[model samples]
Target: AQSVAQPEDQVNVAEGNPLTVKCTYSVSGNPYLFWYVQYPNRGLQFLLKYITGDNLVKGSYGFEAEFNKSQTSFHLKKPSALVSDSALYFCAVRDTKTGFQKLVFGTGTRLLVSP
Candidate 1:
């Protein structure tokens, strides 16, 4: 009973502006959260993860995320978006009871950037 949903199929962004991809989750117990990015024909790259402490967690490529407990959500954010940032974003959740290693990925949210 652990899963994630990325509501937006894709997001179009400019070269420089704030960007966000939304995610929501359902789990039996406390969840381990993660964010990953995928390039064309590639697997996912770890962006960030939330195991415990600090609602705000920072990660690779100037990306960060806020873990909201009450809302049962983790949303990824970036102050300045880049053309290079154009890729697919995935939000995931791992069940704490299940060793927190099995990641359930979202359908994936494509991020398109234009120069």
Candidate 2:
């Protein structure tokens, strides 16, 4: 089974300040990790992914995440946050052991950026 955990329910940040949303996962095989963001009443949009290569992966809207194998964590980061950056973020993991791609998503973390 594959699962993702987003420990924080909400994160508040000021505009121009850096922000981070944390996520951790568990999987049977090599994990395919992803982060997605959703605005109010909208569907999730892909942010970034960690399939292979560098530990740090950059994504859309100036978002990036660092994949830590030892800790089984993928924490999303933004160098500078904007008011528009406020949204609900989700962390997901694919279960390779099933031979089928089954994405398990975290509960989601709401980011609030104030001006």
Candidate 3:
């Protein structure tokens, strides 16, 4: 079985400051980690992914995440936060044992970026 954990329920950051949303996972095999954002009443939007390659992966809207195999973590980061970035973020891991058929998502983290 595969699972994800997002310890914080919410993250607050001032506009223009840096931001990070942490995520940890457990899986049977090499994990396929991903980050997604959801605005109010909208579907999940893909942020970034760590399938294979560099430990550091960049994605939409200036967001990035570092995949740490030993730590089993894929933490999302942005150099400069924006008010528009305020949204619900989720960390997900593909159930590799299922051959990428399923994704187990974390209990979302709400990012509150204030101006």
Clash-forming residue pairs, model 2: none
Residue 83, model 1: Cα distance from true site in angstroms: 0.4
List model 3 lDDT by residue over 1-111, tens digit each: 899999999999999999999999998878889999999999999999999999999999999999998998899999999999999999998887747568899999999
Model 1, range 1-115, lDDT digits (tens) per residue? 7899999999988878899889998988777889999999998899999989999999999999998889988999999899999999999988666574778899999998888
**Per-model TM-score versus the true fold:** 0.93, 0.97, 0.97
Per-candidate alpha-carbon RMSD to the true structure: 1.3, 0.8, 0.8
Which pairs of residues collide in model 1? none
lDDT of 2 by residue, 1-115 (tens): 7899999999999999999999999987788999999999999999999999999999999999999999999999999999999999999998776678778899999999999
TM-score of 2: 0.97
The 10-residue segment of model 1 with minimum total lDDT is: 94-103
Error of 3 at 8 (Å): 0.4
How well does candidate 2 score on lDDT at residue 72? 95
Question: lDDT of all predictions, in order shown?
Answer: 0.90, 0.96, 0.95
Candidate 2 Cα misplacement greater than 4 A, ranges? none
Measured by C-alpha RMSD in angstroms, how accurate is candidate 2?
0.8
* Candidate achieving higher lDDT, 2 or 3: 2
Please report how far candidate 2 places residue 2 from its true position, in Å: 0.8
